[model samples]
Target: MIIGIDLGTTNSLVAVWRDGRAEMIPNALGHHLTPSVVGLDDNGDVLVGLAARERLITHPHLTAAVFKRYMGSDRVTRLGRRDFRPEELSALVLKSLKLDAERYLGEPVEEAVITVPAYFSDAQRKATKIAGQLAGLRVERLVNEPTAAALAYGLHQSEPESRFLVFDLGGGTFDISILELFEGVMEVRASAGDNFLGGEDFTEALIDGFIDAVGRPRGLSDKAATPALYQALRKQAEQAKRALSSNQEAEMQVLHDGQTLSWQINDAAFQRLTEPLLKRLREPIERALRDARLKAIDLDQIVLAGGATRKPLVRKLVAKLFGRMPAMNINPDEVVAMGAAVMAGLKSRDESLNEVVMTDVCPYTLGVEVSEQIAPNRFQAGFFLPIIERNSVVPISREQTVNTIQDRQQALHVRVFQGESRQVKDNIFLGELTIPVPPKPAGEISVTIRFTYDVNGLLEAEMTVEDTGEKHRLVIEENPGVLTPEEIEQRLRELARLKIHPREHLPNATLLARADRLYQQTLGEERQWISSETARFQAVLETQDEERISAARQALKQLLDEVEGESWL
Candidate 1:
């Protein structure tokens, strides 16, 4: 059976279309939400999800989290004695989710539809697909997160014709999509977002505020804050952020160097701290509305998706901006997964979904870099010539004709890029290819370059020498972020050697890791108590008695919860 996966930045979830609806699959820990964290345990076993997240504080050197922000880049995160690319880390999470889906479905699931941010670039999308490949799953489709959300909502809407906007604010990325539904078709009119802006940024804002307010006064330099202390502060900030969403005030406290640092923030203060991030959210919305050629009053509804949208502050901003309360009938955290499941069903040709048609747009302008003549015998390089404008409907092919700039030019070098900038250097270089032409004077030789963007958002460029009818295709294999077939195979072999921690031990390992992290964060009596309890639990595990071990696990978990408060979920 084909499953749907929401390969998110902070958390990931797997779902499937069963019983005529999308059903979320629980992991080994019996939870639908899995933190997107990866780490290597002391025993050299790979760990993912809660266990890995808990290690961020106690075993910071062996763990990695929030690596999704570096997707499509050359950034490498070092965990334990090895280094990993963002896609490799992501593949580990995908593998865990794939196992969960298989266990839940009672079958071997080999294919999936994964959801990504609407504004993710070509390299990002390619990297996502590569991640899926590494996980032993064929990525059937890479659906846009907002488009998937729209599909989930569109399936239930009774109205045959309506225009709505999807405001998606996840942990590490934000996206805005304007969609119109008519006659069983859901067409994304426009898509825009700040990939770096999300709920995590707000939490980071709180972190900075806490540091400025408390750490600075204590003569704590940025370098003076150790990884464990930073993790503790981040955890506290996350908790405070959630608390402020419902409560008028929240307090963040962290223990560092035998001292307790604390900061209190009210709703008003939290807003002030996150104002810059809030400001970044406006431009994307305005751009989407402008591209769709509609105003706030024209939309029938404003649908909110992604876990970050649950924030009261963000909701207030969206409501004030739109002059209407947004829709939250569905759970924000699960909406994208549900929609991804819907897309999977559609892909499999589920009878109930056969009538629905969904369409998406190219989020950015795609064009070829060109040199324009500025004067006699003088030409300026690095000008961008657009082939397909931003927000144009995708699965499209657009072409542009250009003449050779220099006399006796034998070949035209085409550098493809994606962005709104008029200068090529400012845009994202996708790939380049050289098309040979007969030597001739400037403007005597011309070539037509055509770019075809598929439903999966992959691009194919073909350049044809008009006079000779010679055509050459540009394969985007040179991007540093993308892995070639050979590289993927080699990495697959390498991943095969890394063993995952046994599923049966995950719950116990997760609890122990959490206790360890708490041990590092607490001070005085609390720290001593955690240490004793952790040892007691470890001793109990050595007994090998199922009943006694289970009881001890529960008791220790209760104590940890009491000491650490409720979990972020």
Candidate 2:
């Protein structure tokens, strides 16, 4: 059976095509969403989902989440002794979801339809699929998260053909998508976003305000707080933001190092703290609408997705900008998951979803990294593969031909890039793929780089080198950070072979640890939260039957819903 997964930054969700309809398969928590956190133990093995998040307090260095932002970059995170690319870190989370689904269905599930942000770059989309593959699942297709939601909503509502916008303020990324429904196809006209901004940013803004107003323990930098405490504060800050939606004010108190720091923020103040970030929301929304040549009230319907959209500020922003209140009924958090399930149903050829067809776009521009000698001592940077824009239709391939610069250059290299950066160095280099160019006049050798975005948003670069019949294909991916291959290999071997904390006995570890324990003890409200949390944990543990593990997990997770809530009391 085909399943749908929305691999969000702050949270992840899984849904499946089942019993003549698309059904959302909640985690052990009975809730549809699961935090995407992963905790590393003494061994290289990983703990995913709620347990991983729980471990965040006791294990910050070993726990890493929000890696979706680094999807297409060359950064590598070193945990303990091992080196992990952003995708590898993400694979742990994906692997967990696969295990859960298999356990619940009592079958080995293979194919899946994964969803990405409509504004994700080509490389980022490919990385998502790679993560899925690494997690041992076959990626059947890559659908945009917003478009998936549209499919779910549009198919169910059967609204007349018109234009609309999908405002997705997810956990780690924000995507403003303009889509048009015509005939039977829902086409994404344009997409824009800041991949680095999302729900987490709101927490950060709140934290900064808390620090400034209430102040931290003497001599403790906001950075020096323990992993657990920092995690707690961020978690509370998010809760406060949510609380402010209905309540006029939310208060927070934490006693660190015998110092009582207390503060209260009203909805107005909370909005002020996040106002700077809110300013950013307008551009993407407007840009998307303009790209589609439509106004805020143009056609019909404005849908919202992602947990971040739950913020009252976000709703006000959309309502004010669009001159219309967005649609309700769908939970901002679960809608994307629902959409994912619907898309999976479509892929499975489920009759109920046959009317739902989505047309998404390329999120960014694709080009080749090129360097030309402009001066005796300086080189100028440029790129090829122009004309094609990001957020363009996927599963689409294009052939672009170019020639070599130097004569008798038998070995020519093809450097791929994504983004609108004028300088090649500013863009991401997927990898250096070489072609066997025949030794001919400088400009005579010709080669073509075929850029393909499959239905799954996976990219393939096929080089046709005419000179020596040398054809090679390369996948654009993160180069392990600043480490050499030898260093990375040695690091991975050591981390995998021996048990160690992700902090690796570094100075940062001691500082972070000291701050962590301090913060947890001071979080007084956690006492009130203990009973329910314990109950939830115990319920899941009771399902010890191997075949019942999936069911048990779901039970455990039901308690974790509203994870952002402060239990400190």
Candidate 3:
């Protein structure tokens, strides 16, 4: 059976369409949301989700989270003895979700429809597909997150025609999509977003506020706190941020080097701290509306998706901007997964969704680098000529003709790029190919370059000589950030060999990791007490007595709760 997966930055979820409705599938932990965290246990077994998240503070060196922000980049995150690219880290999360789906469905699931940010670059989208492949699942489609949300929302709309906007702010990315539904057709008018802006940035802003209010530890740079302390501060800041969503004020306290640093932020203060990020959110929304050629008043509704949208500050900003409260009947966190499941059902030709049709737009301009003649003989290089404009409907094919720039030029070099920049150097180079042409005077030989962008957002470029009709296709396989087929196969084999920590031991392991982290964060007496309790729990675990282990586990948990409260977990 085909499943839909939301491989999100902060969390991931799996869902399946059942009985004509999308139903969320609970993970091994009996939770619909799984933290997008991966780490290694003491035995070198892989730990994912909650257990791994708990290990962030305890085993910062062995754990990786928020790797989604680096999806299309060559940056490597080292977890334990192994170094992993962002895609590999994401693949581990997808693998965990795949297992959860299989277990929940009681069948082997081989195919899936995954959701990605609409504004994700070409390489980022390719990385997402590769991640799905690495998880042993064939990716049938890569639906844009906001488009998926529109699909889910469109299904329930009573009106035959309506226009709405989807504002998605997740852990590490934000997207804005303006969509219109008419006569069972859901069309995405435009999509815009910041790949680096999201809730995590707000958490960072709060961290900065804390640092400014309460001085940092001695010998530490302004931005260079130790990982453990940073993790601790992050946890507290995240919880406090969430608290500030409802309450007027929230407090964050972290223990560092036997000293307790505390900061309290009221709603107004939190807003002041995150003013810049809030402003960043507006630009994308304005751009989306402008691209759609619609004013705010024309929108029938504004829908909020993604976990970060739960913030009162964000909601307030949306209301102030649109002069209306956004529609959020569905849970913001599960909406995209639900929409993905709907897409999966559509892919499977489910009878219930036969009448619904959805279409998306290319989020960025796809173009080729070129040189333009300035004088009779003078030419300036590094100009960008767009083949397909941003927000153009897909699956689309557009061509742009260009002449050779030099006399006796053996080949016309075509470099494909994606961005809004006017210069080639500022744009993201997707790939390049050299097309041979007969020797001729400058501007005499012309070539027609056709770019085809599919519904899944993959781009293909083909160049044809105007006179000879010779054609060459640009194969985007050499990008260093993307894994080659052979590399993918090798990585697959390696991932297959890595063991996942047993599900039954996760509670104990999580508790132990939490205790260890708390031990490291506490001072004098508290540290010694945590060490003792942790030892007792470890000894009980070693005994392999279920009754004793359960008793000791509960006792240790209660002790930790008394000392640190439940917010940290």
Candidate 4:
């Protein structure tokens, strides 16, 4: 069976095609959402989702979260006794989701469609595909997250001709996509975003405000500090930030290392703290609209997706900017996974979705670096010459020819880059290739560079020396996650050794861990009540009666739901 996965920065989810509809598959915890956290348990076994998230405060040295922002880089996160690359950490999350899917379908699932942010670079997309392979699944395709959300909304099933905008503010990344639907065809006109900006930053802003209100204590320098005050403050900031969505104010009191801090903040103060991040959101929206050559009023609908869109200020800003209320018919947090499932169905040629046709565009300009003479005796060596402009439809090729600058030039070097800058150094360096040219006088040797970007975001460059009729082909394959045959086998063996807790015990473990965390956060009678209920649930689990355990688990979750207000969900 094939399923769809949204490997988000803060949360991850899986879905599949079932009973003629897209259905989200719950994890072992009996919840559709899983916190994107990975850590090592006290017993040294791998812990993911809520279990790991709960331990993040007490075992801050061993847990890692928000690594999605480093997707294509070489950054390593240390989780207890092991250091792992971002993709490796991501693979663990994928493996957990895969296991959940297998358990839910009662089958060995092997293929999946994964979603990435629309503005993700070629390297980032490639890394995501490799993460899937490392988890022992064949990645059939990589779909853009915003486009996936659009599909989930059934924009193609609407009027024959319509224009819409998708403003996706996720946990660790933000994307703005402009799409047009015409005659059962959904075409993405443009895409833009800030990969480093999202809800996490907003939470950090609150942390900054709290620190400003109650001066930073000693021994707290970074997030990695163990037994420090920052983690507790971070958790409280997250809770208060969520509360401000409905409540006029949120109250917080935290004690660490004999230092007591208390504060009460309202919406106005929280807005002031997060105003910078809110401004960052507007840039990409304006850029996407400008690239699509449409005014805000031209859009027929504005659709919001990703968990961050639930914020009231975000919704209000979107409405005011677009002159229309954003559509919320679909749950923002689940829409991307739902759309990814639609893509999976489309991949398998599901009859119900056969009539729908979808297309995507390149998010950035791709070109070669060249030298241009700006003055009689001066030249700029890193000028960027665009072969294909940003937002161009995929599966397209463009060619440009250039002459040798010096006499008897023996070779031509073609350096590829992706960006919208006049200077090549400012852009992302993709790859390069050199072709031997027949010795010739200045301006006598001409070489043609052809850039072909496929629908899967694969870039192929061909350099044909005009005089010799010889060709040099380069398929830029420097993705950090791309593995060689030997590397793949080695990684497969390495991953095989990692163990996740058994499925039957995950729900109980997650609940107990959450209860333990609450016990740490509360005081007086509240703590006593939590302790009593946790002991009762522990006693029920000891009986090992499946039905009784399930009922108790539900009861505990409901009780916690009343106290926590479903903020985590």
The prediction achieving the highest lDDT against the true structure is 1
> Which pairs of residues have clashing backbones in candidate 3?
none
Question: Judged by lDDT against the true structure, how good is candidate 3?
Answer: 0.88
Which residue runs does candidate 2 get wrong by more than 4 Å?
A: 40-46, 72-89, 155-157, 216-218, 371-379, 383-387, 406-411, 439-442, 464-569
Instruction: Let me know the TM-score candidate 3 reaches against the reference structure.
Output: 0.96
> Which candidate ranks first by TM-score, i.e. highest?
1
Q: Candidate 3: lDDT of 337?
A: 97
> TM-scores of all models?
0.98, 0.80, 0.96, 0.93
Clashing pairs in 1: none
lDDT of 3 by residue, 88-196 (tens): 8899899888888888889999999999999998889989999999989899699999998877775435588888999999989999999888877888899999999
Ranking by lDDT: 1, 3, 4, 2
Question: Which scores better on lDDT, 1 or 3?
Answer: 1
lDDT of 2 by residue, 464-523 (tens): 876656678876544323233354455445434543233212122222232333335434
lDDT values, one for every candidate: 0.90, 0.70, 0.88, 0.86
